[model samples]
Target chain A: MFKDLDPLLHSQLRLAVMSLLIGLESAEFTFIKEKTNSTAGNLSVQLDKLSDAGYISVEKSFKGKKPLTTCRVTKKGLRAFEDYVTVLKQYINK
Target chain B: MESENQILSTEQSLEIITRMIRQAHGSAKRNSVYLIVWGVAIILANLGMFILIWVEYPRPYLVWLIAIPAWFATFYLSYKHRQEARVSSHLNRINSFLWYSYGVIIFTIVVFGFKINYQLNPIILLVSAVPAFVSGTIIKFRPLIFGGVLFWLFGIICFLIGGPWQYLVGAVAVATGHLVPGLLLRNKNDEQHVQGS
Candidate 1:
């Protein structure tokens, strides 16, 4: 039997964000927006969704006068990503 | 970017993952600033000391004072780099720890150089090789690995040859080991920037 893909990670932008965050210690909000080629509003919404899911942690702070935001994958997020990839591989091989 | 809930095919998901991971790799690009700054500073100090000693200057060691400004420059540049950095990765932390540990160890050695009878050149060169070699291996840069080996070789030679000549040898060691590799790294960084643009 084939396992269903995680709905949270089945979208384009969220998957891209997770893929980017997976290899990094942390990444700034602006960096995610730029890399994903998404508008600030759209990226923020997706990040919030992931943050609410406990798949990632978001920290908001200030860099001088400007507010800076950074994100990292949580341990649970890592496990989820790994499981997602394994299921993905299985699907591809089938 | 697609719509908020736009579902992706398995192939599309895999493609996004691959592409994003490739983009993340850019964060790991080595900054050549520290290498170049220290390389030039060392070359200047070694050659300055050698020239003054050859000219019979009463305080040839005063040339070592050149390090004060270099330290300030490094501090400023590092602060600027930290501010500008968009992403932090494991490789970045590893590189920072490698250099920070090197600085502490070298500082300790320099403070106790007199206890070792001022046989500082050979000891300094040998100590310098560890970071260079490991950093090269970490970044997969062959020139830095060769530079590290050259440092080891020159360090051994320093032990064989004594006195003022050791200062001259030290200059050559840094020129090949530090300066050359630093310049090559800068060149590679520039090429990458141009291509990226």
Candidate 2:
């Protein structure tokens, strides 16, 4: 059922981010940046796309005097990820 | 009004992604506060017990039993909070580590204070390794795995050292092992808060 949905999440960068986030309750911008090896500009764009699709959420705050950004995956996102994985399995099985 | 088929601008996409991540986990401020409070209380209780032992107090063993109820309290509070806020598995894993640490510390003090003759080497190793192992497995944290290895080494050392020094070594082992990791976790939590805003 979800096999067809897997490709929606298979993008190299987006998949990396999603995979990392799936394992975290929340992750700091720096952590994600380091993990994905993506620039702030690029990562920000990808994050926005995911958020628009209801896959993740981003919060911006000031830590001391510095700007801090953190991200967490929503329940909707989790469901989508699960569905996506299920879809991917069908393709693999075939 | 030019064309409806145009894709979102890069900036717009980024904004949407950020929002999605934000919505992934609900507000954890309350849970964070609860955990901080719990950590402080546990530290205080341990300190109190330590002082009591230093004073040659009686029935210091009873202090250990306080953990049983404390565990229940923590469970209840966490359960209640879980209903109010969506806590990630990562946060819960860290919380579990904290509680397990507290339990082990209290248990160690109680056993040692009462002059109980139980062989503590294996028990201590198991207690310390379990949380580290779980953390590593669930969170894929190398630091925790390394900490677990250190604990195992300490356990072996305790067995080899034997005699009175075993107590001192055990104290040092735990202080360095669990306490250090707890402190590191607290620091990480602080960093997250800084990042989370």
Candidate 3:
């Protein structure tokens, strides 16, 4: 049986972000930017979108007086990822 | 002086807190799986060595060395998974520490088992200390640090006692150091999952 997932997360960059967050306890903004190869502006936009959808939580803090942004995946995000993969499996299987 | 103050509604605060908790839980779940797998593999390898020793096999110590490649394979798989999935640095740090601990254990065994002066066998206990210290410093896990300290003491005692007992001390120290912390993390992950659900 296929599970329903939010279509918003199906995009490549957003999916990449969710995938990364899904595997991490938390990730710094720079680390996510480096891994996804997304420009800061683009990543910020995508992160805001995910945060809006309640799929991620973004924490802004300071590391040694420098601003540090960290991201983590929510339960909703994990469920969405699982469902998305399940749906993708149908296409591959078909 | 009177100043205006804004208060967030309880509902809004709850929603935000819930989202944060979920995010933390999800990340914990993924990393926990990796730790559990590594833990089981380490325990099984030790069990195999124990069996070899029980059977009075020649050079039974060689069996413990199997963890070298096993750990390498685990790390490679983890790295590939991270690359494919794009796991974050927070998760990566935890995974890295776990694997690094494995590397330290393997190196210690190899060093004291073969290369180090036979007289310094007791120092092997202190070997586990490095990973323990790393775990404490990097992850802020006191248990791991405590476990490392215990191993250090055990190593010293084993050295004083002398003979094959050092081997047992080394094996037990390494095994517990990894196994206990792995299990604790696994349990914590499970609890988080349940709460999230």
Candidate 4:
């Protein structure tokens, strides 16, 4: 029997973001947007959803005068990503 | 590139994960500036000290004061780099902590070990080898690994061959072990940039 995929990570952009953050200590908003090739608005919304779910932590700070938004994956997010990958492999192998 | 809520097929999901992880891995490019700066500084300081000693100057050790400016420059550059960097990796964090610890230990040694007489070269070189070896291993940079090994070899030689001549040995040690590897790393970084562009 195959396990169900995590709904939060099943989406394209969110999965991309999680995968990016999984190996990083942290990443800035612009970096995430650039790597994911998503619009700022869409990325922000998705990031907010991930933050709300406690899968990631977003910090807002200032670099000189410019505001910087940084995001990092949480332990929960890592677990979810690992589970998603395991289930994804299960589905693929079948 | 669809809607944020669009669920991907299993293959697409796997592809996205694999691609993003690859991107993340590539994002953390090694900046050769730290190695280059510190290498040049050490070389210059050793050379300066050797010259001062040869001239029979009363304040031969004062030549090390040149390191103060080098330290300031390193700190400034590091701060600037941190500000400009978009992403931070676990490898970078670990490397930073390792170097920071090295800095603290070196500072303590310089300040307190002054009570001893001309026994610093071997100990300093020995201590320096750890960061170079560990960093090279972590980054998979062979030149740096070899450089670290040279530092160890030179440290032993410095211990066996004593007196004012030790300054010259220090300079040679740094030239081969630190400066040369640093220059090679800079060249590597330049080539990477050209290829990337």
The DockQ of each candidate is: 0.90, 0.09, 0.07, 0.84
- Highest TM-score against the true fold, candidate: 1
The model with the greater lDDT, 2 or 3, is: 3
Interface root-mean-square deviation of model 1 in angstroms is 0.7
| Fnat per model, in the order shown | 0.92, 0.11, 0.12, 0.89
Off by over 4 Å in 1: B27-30, B189-197
Cα lDDT of candidate 3 equals 0.60
**lDDT tens digits by residue: candidate 4, B23-96:** 77542234567777777888888888888878888988887887888899888988888778888887877877
Pick out the ten consecutive residues of candidate 3 chain B with the lowest summed lDDT: B1-10
Q: Find the 10 residues in a row with the least total lDDT in model 1 chain B.
A: B188-197
Error of 3 at B4 (Å): 23
TM-score of chain B, candidates 1 onward in order: 0.89, 0.51, 0.59, 0.86
The clash numbers for all candidates, in the given order, read: 0, 28, 2, 0
Model 2 lDDT per residue over B1-197, tens place: 11213344434334434544543332223433333444444444545555666777886435545556656777788777644432345656575666567466846654684465755544565566665555544434445557677767877787777644554555555554555555555555432321121
In angstroms, the error of model 2 at B87 is 14
Quote the lDDT for B113 in model 2.
46
Complex DockQ, candidate 2: 0.09
Q: What are the per-model C-alpha RMSD values against the true structure?
A: 2.5, 10.5, 15.5, 3.0
The parts of candidate 2 lying over 4 Å away from their true place are: A1-3, A6-10, B1-92, B103-197
Instruction: Give a tens-digit lDDT track for model 3, residues B1-197.
Output: 00112233334323433343354333333344444555556556556655776778887656656666766777787676554442244534664666576567756665665455544446645675665656544554555667778777877777678655555565576566656765675565343342110
How well is each residue in B61-165 modelled by candidate 1, as lDDT tens digits?
888888888899989988988898888888777878998999999899989988998789999999999988888776667788899999999999999999888
* lDDT at residue A92 of model 2 (Cα atoms): 51
Candidate 1 total steric clashes: 0
Number of the candidate with higher lDDT, 1 or 4: 1
